[model samples]
Target: MTAYLPMDREERREMLASVGVDLDHLFDSIQESQKLKKTDFSGLQQEGISELEVVERLTALADLNKRTDDYDSYLGAGFYDHYQPAAVNHLISRTEFLTAYTPYQAEISQGTLQAIFEWQSYISRLSGMDVSNASLYDGASAAAEAALMACREKRLYKVFVSAGMHPEYIETIETYCHAAGVEVEVGALNEAGKTAEFPTEKGYAAYMVQSPNFYGVVEDLPLLVEKAHATGALAGASCDLISLALLQRPGDLGVDIVTGEAQALGIPMSFGGPGVGYMAVTQKLLRKMPGRIAGETVDRDGKTSYVLTIQAREQHIRRERATSNICTAQALMATSATIWLALMGSSGIRDVAEQSAAKALYLQEKLLATGLFENTYDSPVFREFALTAKGSLDLYKLNQDLLAEKIFGGLVVDDNRWLLAVTEKKSKQAMDKFVETVVRLAQAQ
Candidate 1:
């Protein structure tokens, strides 16, 4: 048994008093019907245990999980399993970088500000845009924020989003639109899994699409952007950062805003997050972009310095006048991304992208040759693709079987449709094993 320090009634009262609130006052806003009559501790141990015992208990619980390292995973909808360089962790784990907060006092925080400046520079180059913010929450929220920025810039109440965009990103955009009194119209996807058409309305604020979209099909961005321009709406793209190394930059393709999840740039999936969201905009929408922007300047000593240039968020400006309500940037995650990019450089990133694309193509061809799966779309893909199970094959059961063989299969997007992802980390041997297992399972079915 371990000695425990429980807060007595007197201690609780004292703490509450110090905060200038009573227990009832704290719960005043909560609905009576929703209030819990008693706390439920059903799953917890009733008695306290020693520190060592607590660690052992937690370890036992953790061991119950099917960790990715133990299995060959093909799961990448938005988050990917890219190779994270050892330097990313080593540099990010430094006490100065780990504990640093928002660089509000740039005079004393040059290192943090410089890291952010470098991150912004990298994103600007990656997206081929005029300006990039320090960072946002994640890819979904970044897309939503871009929609808000477009609405504000175009001064319109309606926005058009492609059906090919990630479902979660669409949902997030809808949530932001609902709060901002804006309307979202979802465009249709053609047989090739590209946005087929855009609303021919003149009042639309923006038309958004994702390259290597949810179906893993790259859209004809130039055509889509042309159509959006015809309707006087700015075109926005939520792209995969890694694909940008091989694909043409959205900015060069005339996209007004480019946003994406930067997780592939050395950040671990960690069961889906703490990923950095990067946003870049053309010169026209630069001032309207959300989050923080780091700008280079000269100090009193005539040396170079980096400082927060534009903060259009609610925390920095008057509430009603603010461009957005975003309060802070993902400084640590952004630093990791910056370091990753610095380490990989341009050629290394291109190599990773090319390898991923090649592996995906190889896997797709092998699976299709097995006659067990059919292609969901006939478009070119960067790293991921969708396949439909042939005949009466059950995708759920197939995935379970794959798991049994220590191979985590693709993510099931719809009925009998699996969205499979391939990364540079997946070797040819692993690919062959996955294909063989799928072929055997199809035969069994």
Candidate 2:
């Protein structure tokens, strides 16, 4: 607040005069509609507030938010509501793992580097790629970095993306492309919610698609990869990590690069993010990959050790020649994911995948059986699906009513379409209650 500024009255007047204005007109250049007023500060302008007052105010504000513990949520577009194992926190929270976020010093940070190496190994195996980076910021930023990598590798300024991909991802890619003077052409999706066959054009560096796309429709990865190769372009995909337990790995399908959200693995949604983004690439694209990479080698004693192997970001390499600007990895979230994958193994991931898909299918069936909703797309899904309300429904108001009962509902994709997600966390009773709430709201409306 201005009241607590260290500047005295004379200093303030002089500073105001230097800008050719008095105190009352200091913000005169600002538009009247957007100018800040003293009244906006509420209670901390003229009189200084104590630490206790600040705490009380912040506490009151915090009470206005809806906590996940109090709400049964079904909203997973990218970030999921999957249950995190208790051991994940207990392990990642250890002092050695918790504080060693960035592994710049290889000698002192072997433990951190090794953790990241394990994370990369898990990502590579899960994605079926030959190599993987330490990690990235989140799914959206990782997708952007993938596009950049493709364009740089092929020396082409244009790339093709699927319209079926998440809109947020598309926007992020566009931002990265715009800054780099690259062009992004969005391919169309068929009526069944799958990305259409690639175009016959030849000068693109890569083609990107999201499997189990925004509509939760699985795209034809092999077909798309073949088409991309036919056009002399690399194939890239954004996917869900857990879905790979049951689906074909992208590397086996000829995809050159795989990037996706790993939030479902162990990280909580935390009201949308800070999510862990995993990126894997074939052996050919290892150098082109952005972010850090941890590698294993023997020390002087001939014991196993980990070190920072590759860092191709602006901070490490020549700025103009650097692959990306991102330097540090999301250490805490990545550690959680690595621990979760280690504990889950193959069978645990498969079970989570199966149960999530089963629960999602059951939820969809219940909604459609109510006669108030219909299928939006004719496609198979992993853990999320969409439905079209058959009647006029105020989805916003409907969610409010659900919240009143400590329930958080589906995402409104558009006007009448609802995107519903289910994870291993959702039980039959919870989904039944969601269906009942929707019916009750529809009838009330």
Best of the candidates, TM-score: 1
The C-alpha lDDT values of all candidates are: 0.89, 0.87
The TM-score values for the models, in the order shown, are: 0.92, 0.88
Writing each residue's lDDT as its tens digit, candidate 2 over 135-203 gives: 999888999999999988999989999998899999999999998999999988878889876879899
Superposition TM-score, candidate 1 onto the true structure: 0.92
On lDDT, the leading prediction is: 1
Q: Which stretches of candidate 2 lie over 4 Å from their true place?
A: 1-57, 312-317
Tens-digit per-residue lDDT, 1-445, candidate 1: 3446789788999999998979768888899999989888799878889989989989999988786788899999998888888988999998779888877888988999999999999999989999999999999999999999998998898899999988999999999999899999998898888888778769999999999898789888898789899999999999988899999989898999999889989788888889999999988887788888889999999999998886633455556567787868899999998999999999999999999999999999999998888999988988999998888999998898998898888999777899999999999998998898888876786
Report the CA-based lDDT of candidate 1 relative to the real structure.
0.89
Considering summed lDDT, which 10 consecutive residues are worst modelled in model 1?
311-320
